[model samples]
Target: MKKHQWMATLLSLICTGLGMFYIGTPGMIIGGMLLMALQGAALFIFFMTLGYLGLIIGPLAIGIHIIGLIIPVLYFSYRSPRKPMFDEKRRRQLSSPWKIVVRTIIGLALFAGSIYAGYTWGSAPFMKTAAEKREVQEAAESYLEQKYNEPFKVTDVDYTWAIGSYNLTAHPEKAPELEFTLSSNDASPPAISNDTYLNQLWGQQLRDRLKPLLDELYPDQAFGEAYVFAGSDTVERDYSRLANNADGDVSQNVRLIVFADLTADNLAQEKERVLELIRRLPSVTVPGETDLTIDYYAADLKTPESVKKVEQDIDDMKGKTSTYSFRVFDISDITSADDIEIRGLE
Candidate 1:
């Protein structure tokens, strides 16, 4: 039977190369299938890393598939019917009976796998019953209490079946909501400790104080966002180090990251404003800490000249007697304006 051109075009449009298979164009069929697979993989990656704006594979994949679909439709529509759609010589080289059968089986298997993956991705979140959610909440609560010595209750549990993880949000009587994730294995505990509580409180206080000042100073250019870090070390080693050195007097290192659209014109004025703010900053009192070693960060001063001037200004300020150690940072090293880090306090 002569293959219908429109049918072939429709099939290809639906599934990259299915139309080629219907037209007995085995070589085109294989190519189309491969292209479809590649598009599917790209889409999967896009969905997986959707949080990152840089990972834009999803749109590219869609474009590629659209082009792929268009190419075959144009070829079938314009090609001379007398010349034949299936290349007999190419078919002999690429698509023997066994080869075609194997390819078909592989394609079916992959299609089934994709369907199964989609089903799992769609159903995993809704699959958890009331009893299962209760169990997960109990486990999370116990884990939190055992780890942090806090009386936290699991208020919400969110399951991401695609990643095989659970995002559990808990609430303490007098504290903010604490969020943690648990994987299927639950091999490692959620990355939270006593310092988490301290950092949260410290950050809130710092933001409340600094935000108003920033708004007042640079109403037009200020972001009014401060990335506050209040700890001596990374959270991973915090609990372990504290356990080993229970009596050690560790001074918490606090960092405040403020954003402003600084330019050459206002550079000097902005630098002086930042210095004055640093001088006026209230001492953050943490356990075993009298004063905070505050580091100020701003991204707008990216040019080498601006950075040098800022550093020089800070050094000149440091030359005089000061109550707290002050450091200035250019935003080049920071990935985001909101990113904050504390290496060690003392």
Candidate 2:
């Protein structure tokens, strides 16, 4: 190859400035040196502990690549006289433009492939259907029991996964929805009639079905009574949500609520559900007269010693707390009550 060709080849190799160095261009060398310095600074920022901050600045990467290109070109332009410095053989070998193009293409392809591999590995689904099936089977076994030595089959056990609960058909067009059952070992029988007993029984069945999922997912939290929205049941509506005060210094304080439907059946089922939920939560306790209270603190900020101190303080002040009493309103006769007047006021 000719000397000029060798110089050109070297120029191409450098992509602009380094190639000019092979041809002995002093200006090109200086420009390449400056570019290298800039690249060095960018590289330092990119690899340093403060790389995150560097990215936010967003200039380091562009500076490095721009310098890489500009330095080589500037070198060739300034050192035009050195173009003839290279041997014919070197020139011929370096002049192969195809080789440079192929290398660039290969480098880009490799970069893209690496990105796709990383995303695929990081986003693969972790949960297996087999494990889910097993969990459902175990839940079914726990929900049923024999009555009077008669075997009971858990007719069906269904699974639904969602962020929150809402009634739905396990299968479309299904009727006579399977209900939840909640039971209690309270020795005294509730003063409930057959009709109310059946309704409460339905609610209980739903509770039983939900127990396993709740126990597994929310180990630290307990659910209160299932406030079902039965038709025209105003009392049930009020019980579903009572006013909560946020301005109090206690973080919580007692508030009295009055409800219109205080039937024996509703009271028994609601009580059973609330009690069962509290029993599931390890440290939670429901003051019988009040529906619920903050009995335990599992907060990250509260240390064990702090919790003990708070508990001791509560115990010491228990006797002086008669000013606050919680009344869970379960009134039965509001729908039938009305004010009556015999004469118009003058």
Overall local distance difference test of candidate 1: 0.48
Q: List TM-score per model, in order.
A: 0.40, 0.24
What lDDT score goes with residue 196 in model 1? 42
Worst 10 contiguous positions by lDDT, candidate 2: 336-345
lDDT for position 124 in model 2: 26
How do the residues 1-346 of candidate 1 rate in per-residue lDDT, one tens digit apiece?
A: 3345576566556654555554445556666667666655664554455435334764666676576567556655664556554443433443456654555455556545654564455444445666766777777677657756667666776665556556666666456533323433222433322324444444445455555665666453333222233334433224323323434444333343333433457545645665555444433222343232343334444346544543333332233232222343532223332332322212
**What tens-digit string does per-residue lDDT give for candidate 2 at 108-164?**
343345334433433223212445434443333232221112222223322322211
> What lDDT does candidate 1 reach at residue 233?
41
Local accuracy by lDDT, each model: 0.48, 0.33
Model 2 off-target regions past 4 Å? 1-52, 55-57, 78-91, 109-346
Clash tally, candidates in order: 0, 23
RMSD of 2: 21.6
- The number of clashing residue pairs in model 2 is 23
